[model samples]
Target chain A: MKDKSIKMLKTIGLGFTEPLIRLFSGEEPAKNGKLFFKQALLPLLSIFLFIAIWYAGATALYNSEAEVRIEKARAEQGEEAALAMRKCIESGDVSCQPNTLPSPAQVYTAFKALWQDHLSISEKKADFKARVADTNSEREAQGLAPITYTGRPSFLDQIGTSLKTVAAGFLLAVFIAVPIGIVIGLSASLRTSFNWLIQIFKPVSPVVWLLLVFMIVKTVITDPSIDKSFIISSISVGLCAMWATLINTSMGVSTVDKDYINVAKVLKLSIGQNIFKIVLPASLPLIFTGLRITVSVAWMVLIAIELLAQSPGLGSFVWEEFQNGANDSNAKIIVAMFVIGIIGFLLDRIMLSVQNMMSFNKGIA
Target chain B: MAILELNNVSKSFGAGSSRIDVLTDINLSVREGEFLAIVGFSGSGKTTLINLINGLIFPDAGEVLLKGEPIAGPGPDRGVIFQNYSLLPWLSVYSNVKLAVDQVFPKMSSSEKEAHVLSYIEMVNLTPAKDKKPSELSGGMRQRVSVARALAMNPEILLMDEPLSALDALTRGSLQEEIIKIWSRDRKTAILITNDVDEGILMADRIIPMTPGPKATLGPEFKVPFERPRDVTNINKDAQYKRLRNDILEYLIEVGATRRQVSDQKYILPDLKPTMPGRVIFGRKKKKDKVKYF
Candidate 1:
């Protein structure tokens, strides 16, 4: 028995020591590392390849259309037609000109110009601050006017606003939905009575809800006490986002294992204690999954809300730029698209990290 | 004094036309510090019997007296160890045991409570796995955690429902030894519901064979007068142990055969194909199948 105890201690000691040694010494990567990379490589490569193909196709279409229009102009209207086309192209109104898509080179030039302007704005802001101490009157007269030279909201500002709206809507949904869901789930009669209402409301279109919310915000909140646009847009997003969490929480609580309930009964646990210790822990995995789905849905829906409500978010920025027909608009659109994608990905990763921390056993694959 | 008494206990489910009786006219008494094993085939009301004792389920017509008082509902006085090792998978072995200890010993100092829980965990030989969650622990280890959790509560009675049935034979044997050692030390009133005849014979001071449902009832109660701290290896050497074991086995065999015969009668067998010239039959033939002089 003594030798067995010693052996057990040695094994446990090795378990702790091995990881530390690997970390400090930086040995060859573990076998699982190769498997992890193998699993991830295909998806990463496919995404990159798809984007490359799309860029190539768009470039080809634009170049061929431009070539056709130039040839037609040279043949029918003489050398003057060529000059007129060049002016239109320089003016960045390629769509107004007949049959010609803007070349990829034009798009790249527009993107670089916008990027340089954004850098200049930051520099200007810094210079303005330094000059303000010396010549306050002149700077006050010049007063910053929403940095309109860029012709579109910078990629960072749009992403930040979109994220803010999503965060607010998600928090509001969590506050209202989870407790109500739990109550409904715990009582069979209540669940039966309320299920019809949930079913009816859950499948309703977010656009219809958005329109209704806009009307309500317009008529009822007359004092202009808040940004009515933000309020309407958030409520719209929340309306769509709330259902997933509500359904998930209800299912999670309802499916809590009978054995745990029996244990609670045998222990004579108080109602509050049972809810906190047993029911909540057992339901966490499901609840987290629901929250994840809800957050994603809210994010996707928030853009639609922004576009409709003209809310100052990534969605509205993308919409306005698309309508304005500016030279740099397409670049801004691409930037906005990538920003939304990355933010959504990050949100999921954050949730995953939190879920991992909350779980007691690391055995869940 | 009788720690528990069941008088004319009967349980039934549903009502009117759909109503079906599960147990009827059951009578039994358990004295303080007695270890009793209830044995039966599948579908027997043995689990229902334990549930009734634990107050998880109510009897349709009966009185279940615990310490001379009728049980009202599930309470900490009767801690139950479930067959599935229902230790909350989210909690570690130590935490699971500690949870019970904390509830039952609300006034104890934190250290005292910790020590109490740890002692029970040690008794079950799960001290090394104390920090491991149910999902991380082996089946035998998880069951040990359940046992520790129940024992840590220090209840007057421990109700177990086939607690070791899911374990492999070797693990079952080891756990049985551990449980016996713990029972000997505390002498708490314990009622174990199991389908294993050998398990009932090995652990209990008395083994009560139960028949199957509907209206299942105790068939016979066999007394085991083996010496204290009986080892499984040497248990067969005792004449009384052998006699008691054989007796219980005989009752189980008879009950099992009767149940099988009733089920077999319900099944419609397909017409048999003609036997091949080279095929040989096995097992004892029916009396009517005697050939030639036989």
Candidate 2:
């Protein structure tokens, strides 16, 4: 049981706990504990210390900003205005905006508030959906087409939109890059031919690609009902992210162990079988590395594309909140930042698991 | 009739002034059920000759024939065991063998293919390691998997390119015996390429040495007169073993420097002072500037 736990920990990259598991499994505990302290405890302590410093810095900034606000109020309106300002700032009233860096407590509260906001907004959406259904049923009874709900999307809706766009974009990138990469990988001449294009376009920034894709999308897509920005942003993400996968896939394909290629040939495997069985499998680890990078690049570029396109996503949400510059806007932006980070981390973890499954080389993370 | 034949085969690499003649005028044939060994030093293009037979690379100037049909490309009929084992590291020993079995005997039932794979694995004494990947096995064990992969294909010919050369002496000895047992049982036409002279004499009916090269070619073939069920240890005491090995070694040494030297311009060579004649002693000089006043 302990051995299995050790393996699982190694697979998930919790190498610190492996020693602990070994210790529990009847190994010497002192040495294991020392190792655990080195690997796990030190890092944890460092993180806590970092947070402490952040908190201290926030407190100092808040005190200074609060003093500045009080001084401003006194200069503008006298002691009464200054007292009111102090009370509002000190009591943390909803009306006044604090000019200080957000404390850890404030960030935590902001996170909770955003989550609650999402839940309430989802409840409202459900209520609106039900009302639309009822009204649509009445309208149908009167021999008319059912009316659709035109409600504004909530913050949660925006998050979902971003995820969907990124997914579509990532998928598009994979579809475009993998096949082209395979063809290029299979043929030296083709690789040479595509090298010029890859080299030229790969270094081009996401913004330029986004504009190019946006222009094409605008002219080609005339459908009024569809959210064109989703397609635009997604295509832009794909355009920006595809270079990583393409470069990696081609490299992986080119460098697949020559011995495997010989074995395939000696087996007299057909071209398709040779490619699918030998080429793809042998190059899978590197290809997956590329894909993981591609997904990350896609996610990073998505915010910019969505913001520029005014697409319904977390990118637009953050942009909108920044423009609002209300008392809660800074906290909300911080909320979106953490959300984006967590999502990116989760995506990478997902890719790593898939990579682990496909790769034959083990015992190295 | 010859099961495998190479006629006036020549091959080279690179182009223009950088062109290197790797093999030249290689002519040989393997009769049905015959075992032939080509022995040579490294860079002698012995591998290039074997690859030509296996149809992995085409000869620039001549034809390769399998059963009187011209060889076009690599085929299932020619199974090659490379010097480095060439077993797919990603696959288990069983799957590595099964891949060949599946491709060569496509009409065989799944159970039959499984049995075939297992039998060859058994032949190589690797049945215990059947489920293990090549990386999990030791060097000798990995070579056994390569042998099994080639054997499972049941090709008309087995082409080994120094298959046992990578293993240690003890492992190489055991594997050599196993290879002979498999060869004798099936009696398929086989070609073994190696630098080991004793290995050639012990395992093959005929031994041929390749001249050292920029353009390497085969020396005269030497026939082995050893009886069946030859033991490697016992063969050392035999007069015939000594004669054949000495004769091949002598020929290889004689012609080792006969091939035309490759020009230094072909390579990006480091700057070094040209040695003055009679200034450098040739043998076992630890560093440069050794001179003998004989």
Candidate 3:
């Protein structure tokens, strides 16, 4: 039972827990202690060190920017004006404050503010929903459109939108690339002919893809009810990120062990069975590898695409915060940056775990 | 009547200057219920021969016939136990055998198919590990799964392409006996390709030695006079077994040496050195003045 749990943990990319589990099960304590220190505690220490460095850097930047502002005031005006500028800056006036980089404490405060904002928005949404419930019912009875909430999205809502968009874009990439990859992979001639096309399109910028999608979607999708930015951004992300999966799938398909093919032939399996049973299973490891790359690529390009499309996602949130120029705007932007990074890391881990599950060979993952 | 025949079958690979004959002018016939062993050195076109019979690859000249009908392509009628144990790694032992059983016996009921798969798994002593994937199985266990998969197809002619070569000696011997036992039940026409002369002598009704290639061909056939249920332990003491083994081995070594002699085309490389020989030392020689060396 314990072994099974260990295997499960290892499959989920949590092999660091193996030593902990062993120690708890009364295995060698000293050995497990060393392993735990190396695996878990060391990484925790590094994280703390990273925050310390960031805090130091942020403080240094703030001090230098403040000095520059005081110096500028002294040069432009008299000594009295410079003294007043220093006093204003010391009093935490938003107008004269150095807002170049936000400290770690400021970022935490910003995170708390966003959380509070989200809570307030949720309460407002609930109040609005309750107020409109009777009218919405009456409208539904009369076959008329219902009232809806049209307020600005909160930080959490923006994150939710980003997640939804990425999911849709990833699905689009899989749907577009996998079958095409299979077909191209099966035929050497097709692979050779399409190689130029793939090479040309694989490295296209997400902004260009968004513009291309925007051009087509604007003309084709005339419905105002549909979110045009969402569609445009997702399509762009899909187009920009699908190349990894496409290439990997084809390579995997083309390089399936010849012996397996021979077995399929001897069995007299039909084309469909040959592909699903023999070909797909054999190339699944490679396909999963491609998918993992696709997911990461999709995520990396999504922010740029979302920003260009004007979708209310983390990208838009970051851009808006940058332009807001509020006292805590830099801190909020830093928070968004960390959220994006942590989410990207989590997305990659999820892909890896899924890949490990699909693979029969434990060593493949 | 012969169940399977390779009539003047010749196969080659590549074209133009790169073209080389893998097998040429090969002919053989196996009667129903006969166990035939084609023994040869490694890379002696033995796999090519088995592939031709199984219809995995076509012969460049001549035809492979099954029951007087020329074989067009591979089918379940000729089941091949591949050299590398081509059991699908993603599939468990049961599922691997079930895949062939499902294809060959599609009309069979689900329960019947399950029974068939399980029976073969039992036959190869892999019933306990039936739920385990090929990656989890050892080399011998994997080969057993391969055997079970091929047998589950119930092919009229069984083709084995050095199936036991990858296994240890003990596993190989036990598998040989198990195969013979299985073959005797329905008396299937089995063709075993192997490099072991003793294996050929122990398992086959007729043993045929293939000479070494670029254009490898079959030599004279030697008949194994041993009876059914031949014991590997006691067979060593038999004078007949020793003579047959020696004869086949001697013939293989002789043909192999002669082929090597004829095919030898040594090239004389040009005697050349670097432009700055004193400065550039090659092949583990350190220069006196400089520290760097190749």
Candidate 4:
């Protein structure tokens, strides 16, 4: 059972955990200790090396800039003024180089603060809900519509909103591309006709698609009250992210093993039955790979689209902080950068597990 | 009564000058519960011929008839066990067998269908491996699953395309025995396409040699007079088996020798001396280019 657990961990692309698990199980302490040292310790050491380099570089650059500022103050006023200016930069007073790259500590502090802000927002929301519950009942008694909370979405709420937008766009792309891809893949004439269009539209970047979507959304959706930015961003994401899925699904469907199709034909499966029972199942691995890529592309592009459209999401928060150009804003932006990277990593992992569950070659997945 | 018949069936790929005929002037019939094997080299178009019977493909000329009626497309009446054992890698052994049973025998009660699937799995002696996927099973076990899947459908005819060709010699021999055992009990009309001569003789009631390709055609048939449930150990002692094997092998040798002789007399291209660019790129050979043989 200990051996099996190690195998399972390795299979999930968590090979680093295998050595650790083995060490705990006391199966091969010496061997696993060496493996644990090699796999786990080495990567951690490299990360520390990277952080040390970054910290040294940041401290040197900022101190030099502060020296220049202090020298100018001394030239203009006196030694006391220069000393005070140097003290300001050293103590991390927000007035000095607000847009400077944050040291690791600042980023960590920002992360903690962001969590606290989210927690306070949650409490405020709960308080709002409690206050509204009695009023809502009274309003119902008087046959009036219940009042709604009118507050800016919190940082966590923005993360949730971003996730929702990406999910919506991704699902739409899947529904549109997979059917079209299957039809194109199965028929030569259909593929030929669509090939030119696929070639033309596939390379069009998200930014370009966003501009086109902006025009269409402006003309089509006239209601100013609706969350038009969210809709626009979602549609733009769908347009840009769809090509990967379309190409992969087609390639996968077309290249399904000939023997399998012969088996399907020998079984006298209907066209619909053939697609669902044989084609889809056989092509799932490639399809999921395409979907995972599409989700990542959607995520990378969503921030830009959200920022441009001024949608209330992380993209806007980052953009807003960058514009604010305050000392803490730099650290907050750094925090957002890590959040995006971690979320992208998580999305890929979620897709991998889904692929593993459905695919025949589960271990590879 | 003839359960399956093919008349003047010719299949060719490509058109105009590029056209190559695969099957030509093929007229054949198999009686009910007859075991017919077609022996040939790989890429001999025997698979194409089998596909015609299964209605996996259409003949350019003439027809393939199942019973009195023509076969339009493949159906539950004809279950094919493909050369690759085309079981879905995603499905377990039970699911692979149950896929056919569920589709072809939709009217069967769920309990009845489950029982039927189990019975075939048990027949193939794969009860333990029934929950395992094809990838987990060995080559011999996968072939058994394929056999079990085909048999579970309980079709009027069973078509096998070198189903045991991929297994090792030992496994092949054992599987041949297993197949023979299955045939004796079920007595389903079957066609076995194989390159292995011994395997053909072992499993089939009638062995037909297929001529070599570019365009392959059926040569001659040898009927096996060996009694039912004959022991493999007694094959050497059985004069009929030895005689039949010799006759088929002799016929195949003659066909091969004839084909080689014909190809030898065909037009041959003259070997040109290396061109200026070719000499420069490849570096000139020291030997004098003198070839005057016809």
RMSD of each: 9.9, 7.2, 3.4, 6.3
Query: Candidate 3 lDDT, tens digit per residue, B152-228?
Result: 99999899999999888888888888898888899899999999989888899999999998899999999999887
Query: Per-residue CA lDDT of candidate 2, range A1-365, in tens?
Result: 77887777666656678876777776888998888787888899998998799899989998888899899999999999999999998897877656566777777888788888878877887788787897889899999988765567777778899999999999999999998888898899999987999999998988899899888988998989788888889999998999999998999998988888888888878988888889998988889999989999999999888888898999999999889987777778878888899899888878877777778867312
Best by lDDT: 3
TM agreement with the true structure for every prediction = 0.83, 0.87, 0.95, 0.89
The models' CA-based lDDT, in order, is 0.81, 0.86, 0.90, 0.86
Give Cα distance to truth, residue B16, candidate 4, Å. Answer: 4.3
How far is A142's C-alpha from truth in model 4 (Å)? 3.9
- lDDT for each residue of candidate 3 in A140-189, tens digit (9 for 90 to 100): 99999999999978999999999999999999999999999999999999
Please state the CAPRI-style docking class of candidate 3.
Answer: medium
Off by over 4 Å in 2: A67-97, A123-157, A362-365, B257-294
Which number leads on TM-score?
3
TM-score of each candidate's B chain against the true B chain: 0.86, 0.87, 0.92, 0.90
Interface RMSD of 3: 2.1
Ranking by lDDT: 3, 4, 2, 1
Model 2 steric clash pairs: none
- Distance (Å) between predicted and true CA of B197, model 3? 0.6
For candidate 1, write residues B129-218 as lDDT tens digits.
Answer: 888888888888888889889988888999999999899999999999999889899799999999997898789998898887777888
Relative to the real complex, the DockQ score for model 3 comes to: 0.63
- What's the lDDT for residue B192 in model 4? 92
> Could you tell me which 10 consecutive residues in candidate 1 chain B have the lowest summed lDDT?
B259-268
Which candidate model has the greater lDDT, 1 or 4? 4
